[model samples]
Target: MQDMSASLEQSKPADSPRDGHLKRTLENRHIQLISIGGAIGTGLFMGSGKVIALSGTSILLVYAILGFFVFFVMRAMGELLLSDLRFKSFADIVAHYLGPRAGFVLSWSYWLSWSVAVVGDVVVVAGFFQYWYADVPAWIPAFLTLFVLLGLNMLAVRIFGEVEFWFGIIKIVAIVLLIITAAVMIATAYVSPNGVVASLANVVAPGAVLPHGISGFFAGFQIAVFSFAGTELIGTTAAEAKNPHRSLPKAINTIPLRILLFYILALVCIISVVSWAEVPANRSPFVELFLLAGFPAAAGMLNFVVLTSAASSANSGVYSGCRMLFGLAERRNAPAIFARLSALSVPVYSLLFSGVCMLTGLTLLFIIPEVMTVFTLISTISAILVIFTWSMILAAYLAYRKRNPAAHQASTFKLPGGVPMAVTSLVFLGFVLVLLALEPDTRMALCVMPLWFVFLLLAYRRRTA
Candidate 1:
């Protein structure tokens, strides 16, 4: 009877195959938009001001350098996924090469990373609402976003894909328009109320290139690494991608170009329009620069875009967290409940779990109104956890290469400098962790980060033993 019961449970279908977790509903266009959308987060829209203040003109170089390194990391990841169609994302690949123990760590850590990130994005959404109405509490928007996303995710993965597609489209259009506006102002040599004009001096001028010198440049590197945090989400969704082998490569190739045009060019335009020293760390210089340049309408429009960008991050946060949880359950690392799916083929349990966690943002706003610090702390911790996952991928790649030299020799999507580039990328990430500790405020992340791992280790020991 016990054996029969076990057989029945094993055969039970939690979700209909048709309605189940995204089965290639994401086409090439959907994949590209999602990749672009994930890459362009609230960080670029909101956090760029602080990064600019920290590194001055050198921040651009920091992004460029970091972008260069992460590109190789993505290439290595892409090569692994293409090597085996069964490999969904980093977690699956880690599990395959390392062990179930490592996979659990990667999966849970990744889920927590995205879950924590939702807090930051949710808080930002609340703040954006405050700009329109002073009395409205932050929790309202946070809670509303949480419920809205919950409903959307529970329906179908395709719905979530479509929403993110448009959310990302809004961001792309806004940035393109901002670039055009900056270009026109530069060509005309128009002076802003701040008495700055577009010129090459913005990048090369003294106190601009290295405002805080090497220290500031390093500081910017840490911040820029955090900004590039979600670029790997493309890999996460690869299993669900309709044609991952083709779509994955296309998405990965776009990263460096995106960084060059969106990140590098955008910053150059902003700094040229306003001095690096004058760019406020607390305020979004993008919006302020538009206002200063006698384009109040564009400023207001950009504010709307920033608001949408925050929402976009929160939306993707739920999508990513739920999927990560589903992946974990498939590997037996998470509760069976997380593996359960609705008639629509969605992992409803994991979806609701993330939604409820995001709703905590509302509780936070009421309990601790000065929640930006909490947001920053969570964001830093999430970034640290992601570095762990990335390292695991490189480690897996090293092992995979050792095991299959012939396959590596035949692969087309190979890293340029081979294993050395992978090792150097790992080392650079470690260096960023040290830099995070150097900052008094960010040091809190180091303190909280270990507690998470300790908890994971305990769980792993209990499960294994």
Candidate 2:
């Protein structure tokens, strides 16, 4: 809808803070696809199974509700970033508006959150690869993917964007094909060998929309919210984006449509092809659809799509984590080494640090394979941190509006509901925290969250002292 190049030219500030020597090599195409890559990942592809198993057909409404509300979160982030081109990273906006203390805690929380997710993704990359070659050492592929992403990121920001762009294309194409194919089959009253008909009737007749009832609907939030965790990634790219004003709003606007097509429509198709009750917990519903339709080749191709999906997530984490560190050092909240960039304008040390953290995931294959679930627990904890980070942005927006009423009034890129939207989004986030507490499995992360804050408080004091 927006003319990207024209908007980019219109929005570029004459001068802003130097990005620690970082380059704005990311083009419009790169940002668009990177935005897509951020929104689609293993959360939807792999974790959707758990959401389907727990939520039943109600996963549709769950994703839609989550998606619709979070757009305000993105909009607030977009307006704040557009208001100040000198700031880099979403965390910087918090620091600028809310004081350095809030910035210090959230910046670290976000970095740790994405770093934890990358560890999980690297483990997953290995697991996905093992499906093709069970004989190979699992850690080998995980380490390979970790190092490869590290290499790509080290070269330049655009290279990382380019790689992620293609990875996003693979995932997009796969979801589109699945949606179209399933629609045709459902229209024809086509039946699989298992005798499951692809029909909208499959959605309701089983047990109404909420098959498992209210508790089941609540159960889906734990995993489904995690599925939405990566959607805020555009915030991290704000500093490096060629044109923050045009690009940020354009990308933010697509969030609703992405939720509809990728999560809602695809899940709709999956349930229609295979009853929610029939969906297996151990395997991806996407693969199950093709295999049931007697298309092993299609199923196999989907496997690779999931593999690349995991890799793309890790790649994004690497990019964002380095930026977080860069933001921290720029604020003098992190060590000076992290703020330094290389000749290619890349945050070399910060990226290597994150890549090293991700490579540690390999130790799971050797030292403690049995307790590998630890990574998953850490990831849930990371999800909690991510939720806090988003909440911080919303909270900062409320502050920004009150503190700078004239700026808020003058901005053309407005948040639709203004302060009310931000307030409601915070309340909804609080409700999600309540949902996390209700589930025993996720309760641990909720309990552990406070400890992270305690550590952050001490760290902040030490840094400031």
Candidate 3:
């Protein structure tokens, strides 16, 4: 491990084009926490209610199943990053093992997904402000916050890391406190304002783990998969980390712990506090669960935490998007200007570009009073695109394994089940795409994806031309 770390540190040239723009104050611990922070967004705080409404108590099963695939997907990514330290990010891997065309698609597809996701998060931030001031327009907070986030990104990557560190800390503390509260309630058989006691039966009653039937059960997986979309941001940070070899694995290894704490334990606690029947779809189920537990203050507190989560996510999008632009420019994949860095060691062009994309939140305000509807579609599409990116990671892993089976054997963080596990994860992602196509609301994302690919192809062709 020490040798690997040293190798990673020395592998890239001091003035290498790939390393030219990335800020290097990000350390191992920051990378680890940011990975968790990036993955655990405000969605769990706000959107889990929809899954409960669709599948009832059986939502837990969906989380477990989807999380299963997501973990191995991360493992595949870890393997690929370790395969060659010169692979600055996923785009590099896609271009190398696959073809430049595949790399181009993966790069822009992820860029679009995260870019749109930033817009969705901006809308959520707008709503977060309205909780305190009813008359304030959502777009005001959304666009204003985007400006603030852009400034932070431009200041330095370490500033972004510091921000995400605190952001992750808040959500982690909230989940810990929530779990403790739920445990106490379960012990006392605490009854809610809605007249339900905290107990195990809540997760098994009525729906009995498949209440939505097999279809609803699968739909819940779609929701769970979306929740896990940004979990792999650690991989992207590898190039910027002071110790990518150690930090990257340490960050990726937290998958099981995060899934257990955030997804499994949190879901169990929510359902245990309030029956699945009481979980609301239109409103945040997290807020409803706390309110049912008779803590009006809890609703406001969770609201604050989720608001931070959204900010953290949009903040992360801005940072990664900038780094991606830097990578693209180094390879001449994006415009030359985007590859430039500031004296502060920040990717200013990427930050400004991402901020501009996020400013589209104003359009949402103009078109829809209830932006959540559109936000959900866009986020789900983001999740679907993430699946494609994860699939590419697995494909890259397969290629790496075939080329250097010994490297796979020698790695410290090998996927436990090897190729079969990677294959299973890929198949599950494909199934998720199928699920996206089947649902009328999500089907729009499926159609949008092909169009997105075509646009990326044209962009790549134009770039090469």
Candidate 4:
């Protein structure tokens, strides 16, 4: 461990190129919105219907439980990142304390996580575009969106931040409007086209919350967990964030509130307005809330919001994947070309590589007749990989606490509950993994995820050799 630490220390000075470093151009507002963007994903907009269908009003409990643990995971991550400003990414912290091989595997695994997620986002966005123009080929919108996002990302880091900021705003406004509209409808006792009245009683009636029993409640975790996939994305922005000490903690601390407002509260409003039993299992409940409230154009507006939400997620994927590649190259885990920065301080090659890889999703659209099936499979795989990523962050935190007791003691932004909380969070994550197997859709991804780790192990050995 001492030798590994020593090597990591030695590599830092050599890795630092005054001109090549990623620019810390991300302001507090950018980090704040990025955090918001990460918390609200396409899964919430698109997949929550399935969660509601399976779990009924118990979906709230599912998100609450997951959000509680996820907050601690972020705290652990925030504490770790703030512990050492030199830690560019969680992979750096993992390599520093858990050894390089673990770091290498995690770096690549995280990249693949975002890669798979972006592909899924691309597929979803194409489907969204076709909602308005049914005759246009799916691949056209898929590739065009990627082309636009890639160009924006290639220009500069702040440009990417600006794009996400507005995307986050759109999502926030849409959810807020939905919540307010639902609240008004519930108060006014507005009735739907099917004669179902909007009322808070709809959400809290006897046995209504768990209509399908505990097993159905358990099934909700599969998709609800996927909705929180990008919550840890804040950790990846440490290298490029301006004044992370202030912005990161503020961002991390508000996670619970975000969950309460954007997830739990929003969901409650939805279930109240359109009883979970009546909510469409395959479509967005958000759009349903607006449409049922007499907004005829709500479909188009919500469709655009979801389209940008998916685009925002894919944009994040592109940004994170390239940055992870850059970090890996800096550590000599990947080809050095990825380490090279453009004049704008962007990792041009890495960005292009990730974008090109995402384009492969277009082919899946052509080959697969059922887009939702492809989305379900890809999203489940991404969720599995995300579990691996969050687990590593917790593990790295434990290692950091053990290896550097003084650092933990001195941290200005410490994770609440420290070591015990980290362990509990890990257990909760494991439980979620167990839940994934309760359904065949997620079970297939769970069974297949091990192959990724095995391949990573082989690659690690060959790289070391």
Candidate 5:
């Protein structure tokens, strides 16, 4: 590992081109909010309804189980990143411990994952816009959003951080308000128009937990996996994060708690207010909860919240895609143009390339007029790619320990259970893959994912040649 790391270090020129390095302008608060934004994905807002409809009360267990494994994934990522500040991203760590080929594939895979996910997010945002302006063209909002985010991202890294910070704040406030309102309704025994009484009993009713049986319980993993797609995004921010040793660990350590509060507790509140059986699979449960509470304008208000949530997710996606492209360029895995930073230290060409890729969202919207269908398809592909990305992180971690025993021993933020936990996480991810095969929608994506790897293999070989 040491020799490989040294060779990798030696490969890059000691002197970089002017403004080649990314700026470390992202502060502790920015990292905190970005972490929150990554944790509370747009899937929780848009996809949770379907998860509840499928898994019933068992959705809680679904989030809990996925959250447990995801937390460990983040921890493993945190340790690997902090072990060396020279590691700008997990791809860098993978290249050092796994090999340049693994790094190349992982970087491009992660870039594709975010790129695909952003397409879904932009599609959803357009749908949210249509909720208010029923006659407006869907492509309008989608295009405007991409253009604005691209402009913000082009200015500087801090602007991107600020945008995500406020976006994260909006999502947090929305979830908290929903939880509180639900608690008040449950305490008052408010009865909905459907004659269902708001009570904690609704969440714990007999047969409620597995209303659709174990198949439904297992079925929840597909979108639930997509919901956790960006949980490891903070790993990509290592290059631009200020005080990474302090901020990265702090941000990652809170992931489990964030999942508990934002996902598990929030779902419990929603389920208690509206029976899991009544949760609309096609609509957001957040908006449903407010509408049940007699808020006539709940749809529009929650629509705005979810719109921003989706925008936040897309924004993060663009930023991550740009960084991954930039990283790939630095390693000579991609065109050198993407490695050139702007005067403000942002990767200008990389940002432009990502924005262009996201334009495919508009084309998808036109082809697939149904928003949910497009979202489900895109999200499944994103989830498959995410699973591959996380698996590589664990695989890289295991190799890091085997090759750098001394570094592992000296690390302050070591992944608990070490090799065993890493193995267990890998097994859990594999099980999720099997679950993906059970549903026709996700199964198609699972089957198609190999083509991406085949393409990557060809690209890697060509790069090596």
Candidate 6:
């Protein structure tokens, strides 16, 4: 009512050196779509079937719980970024609140997480290619997708924003259609191929919520965390966003409802249209629903949608990954050459370095055909690293509360639940780590995580030397 956004844009601190440095070309719509694109991923499109099979109706509860914590994480992130627009990436804020050592660790770990995530996306992209041209080499689409996304990213930040804007729209349209089609089926009493009625009653059926007991429900965390991995991408865009003070809060605020609508509602439709018992964990339930309803065209459409989903994620990986590398170099944690910017104000060298990683991802697919399967292991590892990143964010927030009490009192954006949410979120992240260790396949990631810290420490010491 009092024109909060206008006030935010004008409410710069006395020492606002962060302003006017990076090109703030991203508008509110760009930031909003970026947030949406981050929240939805190949995990939801492909991995939901696995989670549904594992947790059944309780999967709804799983998403709700994780989504709540994610909101708090973003809230903490938004508060930190708004407090100082100079902070470019999460690493910047980590250094400010934590220390240079923590910054070095978080920065590289985040870059590693996205780099591996791009490999996983490339593998998925190649698999999507087989959906049509099985004869073509997997490396073709994998490298080709990376090339196109890299070209677009290197042009300008706005070009990347435009690509993601359309990508997010594609995802939104597909999910909205699913919810509508499923609702119509339920109203018409259309039955699924499995003889299940198109009704909400199926949610409570197939063993009543905890289909495989609480263990199975907890097992949902493995894939669920992967699904939610990129939700923090918005935080990386603070330095590029035209109105970080206004757009940042709006993007972070809408996460909870988007999770409910996109995840909880979409899954409810999937189970109601077909029994969760029948959904396969290995593939997307979206395609299965269409094929069950006798619509190969729709299945194919959903496949294309997911194909774009993988590309969208890869696009984000390059964007966020390059930004992290740039941040690290600027802080002298890495070689200073990566800190140089091109005429477009883009970090060209860092972007190309990440492109090399994407290229290797494609090469791995050809060299070791089994590498595609191992992509799941890589995805698990990415999830663990991202969890560590998010935990640091929450920990940074807690530190901010303690160290800057006056700033917190006078801040325009305030994270609710304060110390409680920070403590609970940290504990929940630890529980997810333990859950990862309990599972045989995912345990490797938790094991490899310590080695990553060791590498970062060694790299940090070498850089300082």
Displacement of residue 193 (Cα, Å) in model 6 is: 2.9
List candidate 3 segments past 4 Å from native.
1-19
Over 301-417, each residue of candidate 2 has an lDDT whose tens digit, in order, gives: 888898899899889988899888877776677777777788788878888887777667557668645223544465577668877988999999998897787778878888999
Better of 3 and 5 by TM-score: 5
Per-candidate TM-score against the hidden true structure: 0.93, 0.92, 0.93, 0.96, 0.97, 0.93
Q: Runs in model 5 with CA error above 4 Å?
A: 1-5, 10-19
lDDT of 2: 0.80
Q: In candidate 1, which residue pairs get closer than 3 Å at backbone N, Cα or C atoms, i.e. clash? A: 19-344, 19-345, 20-345
Candidate 5, residue 309: CA error in Å? 0.8
Tens digit per residue, CA lDDT, model 5, 195-280 = 88999999989888999899999999999999988988899889899899999999999998999999999999999998998899
Winning model by lDDT: 5
* Residue-level lDDT tens digits of model 6 in 246-311: 899899999988999999999999898878888877777887888787788998998899889988
TM-score of 6: 0.93
- Counted clashes in each candidate structure: 3, 0, 0, 0, 0, 0
Give the worst 10-residue stretch by lDDT in candidate 4: 10-19
Error of 4 at 16 (Å): 12
- After superposing candidate 1 on the true structure, give the runs of residues whose Cα lies further than 4 Å from its correct spot: 1-22
RMSD, each candidate, Å?
Answer: 4.1, 5.2, 3.7, 2.0, 1.5, 5.0
Model 5: clashing residue pairs?
A: none
Q: Compute the lDDT of residue 420 as modeled in candidate 6.
A: 92
Query: In model 6, which regions exceed 4 Å deviation?
Result: 1-20, 367-372
